[model samples]
Target: MPILRRFQSRVKFFKASEYMQPKAEVQNLKHMRTSHLVEPNLVGKHTLHACKRLVERILTHKEEKAYKVGIVGTGGVGKTTLAQKIYNAENLKGAFSNQAWICVSRDYSDITLLKELLRNFGVHHEQGETLGELSSKLAAVVWGKSFFRVLDDVWEPEVWTNVLRTPLHAAAAGVILVTTRHDAVAHATGVEDPHQVDSMSAEVGWELLWKSMNISDERDVEDLRNIGLDIIRKCGGLPLAIKVTARVLATKDKTDNAWRKFINRSAWSVGNLPTELRGALYLSYDDLPHHLKQCFLYCALYPEDSTMSRDDLVMLWVAEGFIEEQHGQLLEETAEEYYYELIHRNLLQPDGIYFDHMRCKMHDLLRQLACYLSREEASQIILEN
Candidate 1:
């Protein structure tokens, strides 16, 4: 039970949500159409093509064949944005008899996830006392329904595999679309060939940056255009990063000298990040429960783009006293959970998982941020070498 407590420590107690409206009893909600309507605005040619392909597949599916499609991409490449656009498409709107959107974030639990699903379907705990009973109640609530579900930001395959059967791989003609940052998660959940979202092109990146800032595409403003392009270049084709940088530029002075000064200022000295991307990434980091912050920062020791061995990272965290033993839990187990949290939050990558070892990597921009944040700790690593 020590391990159980340790794992349960991470799962927040599932609370009744205000989002659960209609106020129906569990038996009444066998099918509910709860849709969190996100307004869809997709950009760039490649992104448009990806959306078109996915929509085309859904529209033409005439089989009992599985409709489990996985959209895989690195953090900030905009998988969620693409998913929302596809979900809101005209064809997709009437494709299923029922639909719901649930975000299974980094800190997630099957029990909590089930509760959320039941709540989304307009169910109230009019009676179950155990998880299995709750599960049975959930199955009964969703059983016979033709559903379109989106499990956004899935960090583990178990989230899908462990859910009620009809939610995925059902014989009925419904679909469950998944979005994740891990390739293995896609395969483990039965997605054979996942749609991989690559970074945007430089031209597309500049277009989005300027579009967000309401700047003209004309070539007349040569000085401003040149500086803006440099800023966009530093964004490295990441849509979220470029968007955040554009937000920062929106309020600033548009003079050539001001833009030049921002470009020349050292990201390290500012203790933030290049291109103003730190604000976005830092929100992800800051969302981590206090226990995992040090472990997340410890990742900076591995060089940029280097695949850090999962076991090695755990041991290093243990040695450095970053992981405190809790409720008779093994240090390694808590450390593993810490790793999963970081990956789930889009702060780390799951490169490969082997029988004996799991490999993880940090993105280049995130690595830059970690070093900037942990300057003193990173200097210790540099000195020991």
Candidate 2:
């Protein structure tokens, strides 16, 4: 079998319950009931707009042998979002003959990363090929072509220094964009001045909160505006916090009492180190229904920035007995409902670039929180190892 087919086979095997008897068959899930591609309402995203213009200028006007740029920020500060916007810009279409977006998360081996890059660039290689063989194949593919590539969530520098540098050395005109949390990684990728993404301002946070609430009435907006601003200040103007906080508030009755109750919650005033923004995330996690909690936490088992297939996740949930039974519904169907609920609550975001609603990725902060909450289980696994 070919490499891709074998990979699919392994995934199928992994999704099956190894020690349990066969269970009732559940029909494969169809289309997603709701879209999770909701664009955040960043009020006057001046920095983002300016960054796009800069990317265009570098890629279109620069005459370097191989142009590179980096976008660096703390997790949840919208580095990936900015890169996505630049990747899909309309004005830049047809500017390069080849383009690809590769998510290089914290856990990536050199060979696997190289293979993924080849796959995205429409190159094929045998399954057991050695590193040198793959490298030469990649070199041949980009030998004389103008290509644009986005490497998202880079953690280390070896991806370029060890694997990509030699292969891409001969490209006619290559433009590479990298998004990372570490300035070291950005600099190692040869970017002297990586664009830094900052948290939103107080004003922008309010816009995000109000937009997320989907509130319509001006009177209600005015009435809650003072309390809303006060509560948003606790979020520290982080977009992720404001958005998750809005989801929490949206569940309550739209009244001063409800908003006040949320503002007085303990999560809003806890930590100042690592991330003050995590308070909002904890609130969102706390708000999950019992069954959905298991499903949401289970997602943290995936590597950082990795996308999980909705189908495989639901099946695993069923196998783990996480999905509670509902009247007149199959377990898979019920599990699918849980999956969509997490997405609706913004605990899971649709992978907008690579896959549609069929796959989802959890924000790194949210994943960290999940792992923290499940530290006992993690500890047990560590001891066993």
Candidate 3:
């Protein structure tokens, strides 16, 4: 009797264990479905020396419970690429318990941004929910965990207040990284100094150009190398410009004459740029203040790779009536502010060849953009040659 009762008890225990197995499986599935860790592929030899150090601090620094890092640069200056590299670094892989990247462009909607972010977290939403409700829920769920969030292409400061400022900030281990082209936006969103990404150097630009053409750098064909170096210089050390111009040149004759013709041709005659590069360059131009728009386009008057002094450029603007005399400010002073703003925004390069900050040069592709937009969009006045 005792043996039979013991066997019956064992049978009941086995039945209960079987019943819990499906529940355990369901719980495991639920846990597995919510993972949002992302490791992006790092491309190019960006060698972002400054950016890497900032990223390292983000990964290892435990001094702060939470913080925000700002990456500010002009479009196509490789901000996105640098951010991707930071996101995928070995030090960052296990640094955060959860990770998400979201694009918060100028057109981003508050509700949509929250919903997308939640979706990245593998959280589903009903159609009629309000932003407040979503934010509360997100904050609740993300409260105790370490969260690494990347907000790419942020345009307005309101994006932070509405979307991530409360929830992510409340998390004890949250680190929010934001990318913006505007210094104002960067300063508003960050608690620390924002890293300003600079244009690639001439050597880096040449490497990128050659890499785009699938050519080896080891073989130094002198004539072709000279023209290629000249082309790189004309590209103004902007990677996208070098890439677009190189891709265009790749389809032409392999000889130096073909490249020389491309270099010699007026930017206005180069026809359309690669739409990707054109659109990226145009956004920076489009964002300029109306009063400064013509001031910037005036840069196209100079030849590609030509350097002009700031004083000369400002004087020209004043002569052209682009600069209006403001109350208590010299026309040249106001115009110099415009020049510095352009340089600050990466629209113009300081003349490194002359090693003079007083001098500036327009990138050829940007010159192409300026000339094209001035003609097509504004019907800008053209002085006779």
Candidate 4:
């Protein structure tokens, strides 16, 4: 029943497996309008277009046939971004009678997802309904209607085959767009030709770095070009890594000495990241001001893909004494400033679905790093349900 389970030993913790899924009470959510899924200003425009082409080729469905397509990539490689672009494409307007965007976290609950799907279809299920009842309600809603669904951040194929596929297939015609970190998940979910999102090239990576920092001066470009490329190389062409590193650079003085000092930071050389995303993630955490570090790491306690409201985070930080008292500021105000700072540093991402400053989410990889660091700091920080 724990969202995150721990081994009997005090030090080791693991997320709840899909089978022993956590229970989530369904809220009566308003229909998810495509207008609400605001697309972030993305880098690598060419990749977006290419991904769109792939989706179109597979899902165009001139005869209203059902299609299952996937956009697969490593964490932070922009799979979600591509899916958003496709979801908002002008040409695809009016092609489906209804659409829904669901964020399927690592430990998804079948009943919760079924309820969410019905919510997106503008249907409300009665309390105490069985899985059979929820499925029937979902099937009724999609029956003979054209549907489009975006299942974002899916972890396992069973979430599709065992939970969603049956009811959704009742549509007159439908297209299921799945975004995942594993190609196996895509294929298992019926995405026969999942599109693999490649890492950014050196040129695009530098362009993204410069754009993120608003660095356009010809002399500045020349000054930082070599060091910037080296930084990008360490990033391994991951957009998330490049952007996080850019935030760290943006806060430093734009001088060769200052830039060199940053590039030579010791964290870059060592630290275990999922793969090539090594130092950039650690550097982002390391560069955080001491006060913000605790606040940022505390976020790792939440489940992956979890959204936290700004007020709630600020209050939590205040309760835990993570916020320093400013001479003329309320603790809440200081805590709020910390929240915005994390967002500025790209340590926290704005929850796109809500489209407001009130809520934000931590990237999964960042959360993992935070959890790892938290465990290292206080061996007694035991995770339980």
What's each prediction's TM-score? 0.60, 0.83, 0.59, 0.88
lDDT of 2 by residue, 290-330 (tens): 77777777776555565578898898788777888889999
Clashes of each: 0, 0, 0, 0
TM-score of 2: 0.83
| CA lDDT scores, all candidates in order | 0.63, 0.72, 0.63, 0.76
- TM-score-wise, the better of 2 and 4 is 4
User: Model 3 reaches what TM-score against the true structure?
Assistant: 0.59
Which runs in model 2 stand beyond 4 Å of their true positions? Answer: 1-42, 60-62, 269-277, 353-356, 376-385
Give per-residue CA lDDT, model 1, range 1-385, as digits (tens). 2222222232222113222222222222211121232312346888778888988876666233446788999887878767877777777876776677766655455666677677767887644356676677776776656677787778898887776454434335566788899999988987768899987777777777677666764652454777777776666677766664665565567777787776665541334345544544554454455667777766665433445667877876676667877898899998887877666554665543244337665755577666666654445555766
Deviation in angstroms for 20 in model 2? 20
lDDT string for model 3 (156-242, tens) is: 988886567786665668777788889899777754788887777766666676666666546644446778788777666666566
Per-residue alpha-carbon lDDT of model 4 for 285-369, expressed as tens digits? 9888788888887777666666677987897678677788899899999999999999988899876566457888788889988
Best by TM-score: 4
lDDT value, candidate 4, whole model: 0.76
The runs of at least 3 residues in candidate 1 whose Cα sits more than 4 Å from the true structure, single-residue gaps closed, are 1-41, 62-66, 166-171, 216-223, 268-385
Predicted structure 4, TM vs. truth: 0.88
Off by over 4 Å in 3: 1-46, 220-223, 268-385
